[model samples]
Target: MTEYARGLSHEPPLKPERPQFSSGPTVKFPGWSLDKLKTESLGRSHRSAVGKARLKYAIDLTKELLGIPDDYLVGIMPASDTGALEAAMWTMLDPARPATVAAWESFGNVWIQDAVKQLKLPNLQTLSADYGEIPDLSTIPQRNDVVFTWNGTTSGAMIPDTDWLEPGREGITINDATSAIFAMEMDWAKLDATTFSWQKVMGSEAQHGMLILSPKAVERIESYDPPWPLPKLFRMKKGDKLNRGIFEGATINTPSLLATEDYIAALEWAKSIGGRKALFERANTNADLVKNWIEAKPWLRNMVSDPAKRTNTGVCMVFQGDWYESLSDEDKAAVPKKIVKLLEERNVGYDFNGYRDAPPSLRIWCGGTVEAEDIERLLPWIEWAYETVKNG
Candidate 1:
């Protein structure tokens, strides 16, 4: 049992003001609402001047907040993070060259499937580790094309740094940074193609993917054409030249203007909170709260053993202690389900179950949009639910 939960009070802990904590589509900024979104671009043709300006507003703000280099290009893509990542894999990876893939969790494995199964790159090297651990990045050759995730959305493991990448690497690095962009520090100097969705760190609506391409990645797309067919959405180049229009807000497919407005509003909120520094502080504070809570309890622990590799967002937690360890396999698996049911029943939290492919866990989201007070309020309720479930 936890230290603070030692008392035998039957009353429930106080509820959080906002208990919505899904990893994706997370809780909105502290004061977000429908009325705050700009409606000028709604129902208007995206090609029109005002519509393009509206889209560019979100793009420019993203670049500003991210501190992207001047030479790099940032564009909005058709699908969510999946689409943006797929686009990068298709356009940049030359099947002729050998490729290296590193996977520590669900989303990273998806990129592996894309490389070996879908893209069918003949000479491929795959590096993988268990759910809570990271693979050795140093094993990969410096010049081989590499694909990886900046943060494991499902596994709670994250790469500490990109020192494994050489400064003069010949091969491109494609990164799925959906959960890490705003909350964590990125080494843009070594990253080639980076993709994210607004729904992740900013707590905005989904459906559109944001892509940033380094000059090297752009050159590869412009110079080389892969042997396989390119989907219309994945074709980022027109003839031999880069499709600069897409980078300039001429989307290949029609975009949801309402979603764009929501993204803009969220970016405004982020800027109001003092940009990247504040965002990192919010995620760090919430993650530390969870870490301290876990440390104080005998029955809980972080899935990731190494502190440097643990993620600030999408933190995966495993149950410990004699009772949990003594349970049969089936009964152990049922523990998280019962606890989740109790939490949902009380409206304390929702959608925090670990990914289906992973070991049973309570995957709490400690991203920038999640407030510290709400996390503090929610933790005790989780303790209460666990105690109630275990006692029964």
Candidate 2:
């Protein structure tokens, strides 16, 4: 830090074109504007002909954008990712079967709590790790129900691949893929129930979650009666059979037509840019910009020790070096607090601070909606802020 911190100009770096880097509800797609969203569906009952069609269109576009299997089901749920995941949990997971729930970050921890306390699964095996590290999930039982997150948004760590999943596995696998859907590879075959919200990789409006189910998951729901009572929002079954209307576009409750329009625009944007492949490339390109910047400097480092396990979206970082570590714990905490505050005050960055429960650090969104050039521009601002705060 001392070596590169010297002889630098006091002037601040050029501002990024868009300073939004929030992990969820991230920056919108380039060229996105209010006028661009469709207004025909606004103010209408979501159950009306026009509103239902609009909602279904978003679901169809999602399947097309991600190349989801035709046999699978995709539906819009309320309360964003949390609701979608919980719906799958309450309906699909059976109390009779032993299960494995794995988590390595804050949201993952939420699921662990759901299984242990909320669901009260007596035979659950909980796997977890501290922030910035991934728990080894390589040996989960093939016959044990499993729940895991594809990417830990708070930890900046991701499961690198699906090699751990077996093709002949009997138990269904539920995945929380909010941050990984567009930016990371999703091995659909290994995943039984997958959930995400438009607010993540697509950078659309929030509060609407997408719940996708594989054939195996649907079968489980049909045969298994929920041991616990489900709320109106979590009920996917209409009496004895699965409610197919939800998957076909009739939501349990009203959805924000405005957010639906914004999400549709995002999916359309994704198609124009070469679909899923292009989205992953853009996110990786932005992550690379940050990765290179971190390598070139001595003062900062990626929070994840293994580069392979880090997520392209929500890349987290922490300050390093003897001079910084030598400071008191309170001072270390203040460093990122001050750096983020300075950057935010200058409008050079926004919502890029690390998760509160984790160590004091930085978390930058490198999702497809964010441009690589903006990341390159923002790197210098981070360094400048770090120095400014540490020195003062």
Candidate 3:
């Protein structure tokens, strides 16, 4: 039995008004209404003029929100973030040059697998770190194309800054920023290729990938031909020239016009709240609320020990009681599942379980869409659930 179980306590008085906090398809913007997308060009061919205009509007809004460089090309691709990343990898990676992959979590590991095993690159250097830590950026060779995830969503670890990247490197840097883009600041000047999905930070629909490429990355596509055969979805170049139309609203395949409108609505919401700075502040404030709660509760500790590396979007935590530590791995896993189930049953929170591949812990979505007051309300329920599970 745990100390919390024995202590005299009453259940928390309030419940969060909204309880949709899955990391992907996160809680929609506060006051989001489906009616807002009524203007969407529904049932229209994506190749039609109106459809093309809507797609272009989404691209322009993304550029405006992120402040992407004028030289960079932004495109909408198939298969969400994975598709954008795979397209970049297949189209830009030079078979002659060595490839370097840095993986600190599941998504990063996927890229590593693509480069090392799938592509079977001749020269490959893999830099890996544990769940809570980032791989050492200094070990990556400047001459080798490097691939890494800016934020490890599953692990709740994020790269603190772009200082680790060499400013004058000969090779390109491919970053998967699906969970990091709008919630955090990125040094765009240092990144050659960046990819994200609408479902992550913006709480929009899935299956659409946003691919951003620097001039250098575009040049790589035009200059170097990959040794592997390119799929239609992965091909970014037509003959020796880069496909310029793709960057200007021409998609490799059909896109969801409704999803495009939702993204536009999300971007408009972002603008209404003062854009990137406001979004970051919301996520940071929610995270700080949880951080303070974690400090007050001795039984809970952050999954990522380093405060600097902690993710503001996905706040992962573990139970720290001696009782919890004494449990077998299977029991430890079962405890979190019970706690999550209890929270859900009580309507206090939802999808608070850690990533399946990660350590048994609670992974809370603290992104812009989640309210700080709600996080404040939800903490007590979590304590109650944990105590109940521990004692039973």
Top candidate on lDDT is 2
RMSDs, each prediction?
1.5, 1.6, 1.9
Model 3 agreement with the true structure over 166-217: per-residue lDDT tens digits: 8878999999999998999889988999999999999999999999999899
Model 1 stretches astray by more than 4 angstroms: 1-9
Scored against the true structure, residue 38 in model 2 reaches a CA lDDT of 90
Q: Write the per-residue lDDT of candidate 1 for residues 1-392, one digit (tens) a residue.
A: 55534433643557778888889987889899999998988889999999999888888999999999999999999989999999999988887888899999999999999998998888899999999999999999987999999999988888998889989798999999999999998899899999999899899899899999999999999999888898899888888988988888899899999999999988899999999889999999999998888888789889999999999998999999998999998898888888778778878888888888889898889998898898888888778778877887
Point out the higher-scoring one by lDDT: 1 or 3.
1
Q: What is the C-alpha lDDT of each candidate?
A: 0.89, 0.90, 0.88
- Model 2 whole-model lDDT (C-alpha atoms): 0.90
TM-score of each predicted structure versus truth: 0.97, 0.97, 0.97
State in Å the error of residue 1, model 2. 7.5
